[model samples]
Target: MTETARPAYKRVLLKISGEALMGDQGYGLHPPTVQRIAKEIKIVQAMGVEICMVIGGGNIFRGLAGSAQGMERTTADYMGMLATVMNALAMQSALEGVGVFTRVISAIRMDEVAEPYIRRRAVRHLEKGRVCIFAAGTGNPYFTTDTAATLRASEMSCQAIFMGKNGVDGVYDKDPKTNPDAKRYDAVSFDEVLRKNLRVMDASAIALARDNKLPIIVFSLDEPGGFRGILSGQGTYTTVSG
Candidate 1:
């Protein structure tokens, strides 16, 4: 990475699944993996790109999983939201450890731990070069963190949303893990993704992004320097747009 190699985007929202923070662990956050990802964000920040992050809670508690086990739907979903808050704090600590300024803003307020999500406040933080970690998944049950990411991206007027996946590099024609012959797309239209029921994001989230003309860059977080490489236009990733 060179100082003169400018990025195509000035600001972006990074959507990372809770599973991405788990590394090889079956559940919960892995300190080393979280630190590595924080370094990736720090590198991007050094490039002068403003960032907003939304992390999922599947590593700690998945709403659907809880519901499947007979827990009340709303109750399970709230548990998932709390899990995201925990992940956000962990990420905040890691990013701060590397000297990157961050603000953990939550949709569901717990004033003692995280600041409440206020659009104007978050924008101000970005203006000052601080990464805003949006947590608690819209503060509503049923909506995934993907929707929260899209919502925050739009609210923040981000150039795009960078979705860092754990295993797969990009959107595939089939499950790459299950099918060796699966093909990955370099770029795909939002409608194509929805029509094919691809797993880029949930239908509501995709539709929200499509309606707002927000592009989503899906890439592998497991690859070293992958996030920074993609921003510099040097990596393999899928761009989902209109």
Candidate 2:
């Protein structure tokens, strides 16, 4: 890798599952894991790239899981949104620890904790070189964080959305963990992803990204420098677009 490599995109959104923060633990955040990921983002930001982030709340509470357990769907979803906020704060603390300025912007208003999601304000923050962590899943109960990430990336005019997976390196035809023969594609189409139910993201997210003609780069978050490597155009990952 180059000592100081240039990033491919001027601006991008990083979407990771809440479980990525859990590290080796069964649930919740692992401080070391969070810090490690923060350092990766710091490396990219140092290359003069603007970043937006959306972290899912599966580590704390999954709205769908809660609903499946007989809880009210909307209420459970709101609870899940709050979980994302907690994860965002944890990430914000880690990023700041590495000397990267960050702002936790929430779709739902929570001025005491995070700034309310105002499009102009969030874009300004990115223009000023701040990593904006978008929390609270679109402020809507039915939407998943995947859809929220796509929406935010589109609104922010991000060049692409990077879906950082924990163990899997890229989008596979089947769950690699379950099926060893699962094939990985260097690049796949949005229509195919939706057709096969590839599970890279939700249907809504995939459709929205397709409609906007935005690219989604899926890579391994577990690799030490995977995120930065991608920004530098030195990584192996799958691209889902058009």
Candidate with maximal TM-score: 1
Enumerate residue pairs that collide in model 1: none
**What TM-score would each prediction reach against the true structure?**
0.99, 0.98
lDDT of 2 by residue, 79-161 (tens): 99999999999999999999999999999998999999999999999999999999999999999999999999999999999
**Clash-forming residue pairs, model 2:** none
Candidate-wise lDDT, in order: 0.95, 0.95
The alpha-carbon deviation from the true structure for residue 146 of candidate 2, after best TM-score superposition, in angstroms, is 0.4
Write candidate 1's Cα lDDT for 1-242 as tens digits: 68778988999999999999999989999999999999999999999899999999999999989999999999999999999999999999999999999999999979999999989999999999999999999999989999989999999999999999988899999999999999999999999999999999999999999999999999999999999999888988999999
For residue 202, give model 1's deviation from the true position in Å: 0.3
